[model samples]
Target chain A: EDKVVQSPLSLVVHEGDTVTLNCSYEVTNFRSLLWYKQEKKAPTFLFMLTSSGIEKKSGRLSSILDKKELFSILNITATQTGDSAVYLCARTPNNAGNMLTFGGGTRLMVKP
Target chain B: DAGVTQSPTHLIKTRGQQVTLRCSPISGHKSVSWYQQVLGQGPQFIFQYYEKEERGRGNFPDRFSARQFPNYSSELNVNALLLGDSALYLCASSPGTSNNEQFFGPGTRLTVL
Candidate 1:
């Protein structure tokens, strides 16, 4: 069975602190990886990475995938209270337009 | 364009009663998927429909069923509900089969008594 795992189930940091959330997956046929931020309801899209060594970034958030290691990492810079949310990592498998297997997620709390 | 949308922000039902949750995909999106999220846990896949056909299903029980309409809207039905069936049902829509980026709705919170 395919699976996704995330580390540091929860984190607390100062406003300017930088945080790194980790996600690793073991799937039959790898396709792509996606990141989402959830506050209280639906998850908003963040980034999608398919190739290794190449990083996809947006504003203060960035992510990269290491297919060789079957893992990915999301980095947030200059964090703010508004950035506090649950970060979810999911892996989509090849061969089908199917569901994404998500990690437990990293709950981030940023304080000013 | 409008994003994916779900109905009845919240609901309450007794055990053994049936429930129907609705979803409207983002305009121009041909695929719709449903997921169940329990508090403090990641969303669990339940069903995926594209172009009015079932594309995939999760490990949920037979009591859980869903279908997509010609307009690309969808509905999820849960029969013989139990206390364990209570959860937040999320709907997502994508433009095509290979599109991995799905837009999610606010979700419908279902409570089983």
Candidate 2:
């Protein structure tokens, strides 16, 4: 069975703190990894990582995939309360017809 | 362009009843997928349809079925619903079946009584 595990299921931090969320996966025919920020309804796309070592960044958020280690990490720098949401990591396997297997997700609460 | 849209934001049904959820993919998107999400858990894949054809399906039981229309809209039907069938049904759409990013709908919250 394909599995995606996320660490630190929940986190609480004050504004301006940096946080790192982890995601590890065991899947067959791995294709790509995706990150999403879910707040209230529907998950909004954040990043998609397909290669190792190369980091994808959007403003204060960044993510990198380590295929050798079968894991990925999402880093948020200078966080704000607006960053409070559940961060989800999902993996797409080849021949799966674009279906994604998602992790339990890390719930982030950034305080003001 | 409009994003993925789902109908009946909320629904309530009794056990043994049948329910249907609807979804409309974004304009120009040909692929639509269904997922079920329980509280505090990640969404689980249910079905994927593209170009009016069934492309992929998840581990869900035969009681859960779906079909795509010619216009790329889709409907998910669940028969003989059980108490455990209560969950948030999500619809996602992508441009193709490859590695494209999927856009998700707001989801329908189904409550079984």
Candidate 1 residue-wise lDDT, B1-106, digit = tens: 6788899899999999999999999999899999999988888899999988888899999999999999999999999999999999999999877946888999
Kindly report which residue stretches of model 1 are placed more than 4 angstroms away from their true locations once superposed: none
How many clashes in each candidate? Answer: 0, 0
- DockQ for candidate 2: 0.83
TM-score of each model, paired residue for residue: 0.98, 0.98
Scored by lDDT, the top model is 2
Would you list the C-alpha lDDT of every candidate in the order shown? Answer: 0.92, 0.95
Q: Write the per-residue lDDT of candidate 2 for residues A9-91, one digit (tens) a residue.
A: 99999999999999999976799999999998799999999999899999999999999999999999999999999999999
- Taking the candidates in order, what DockQ does each have? 0.77, 0.83
Expressed as tens digits, the lDDT of each residue in B1-113 for candidate 2 is 78999999999999999999999999999999999999999999999999988888899999999999999999999999999999999999999899999999999999999
The alpha-carbon lDDT assigned to residue B87 of candidate 2 equals 93
> Candidate 1, which CAPRI tier?
medium
Q: After TM-score superposition, what is the CA distance of residue B97 in candidate 1 from its true location, in Å? A: 1.2
User: Taking the tens digit of each residue's C-alpha lDDT, what string does model 1 give over A27-85?
Assistant: 77989999999999999989988899999999999999999999999999999999999
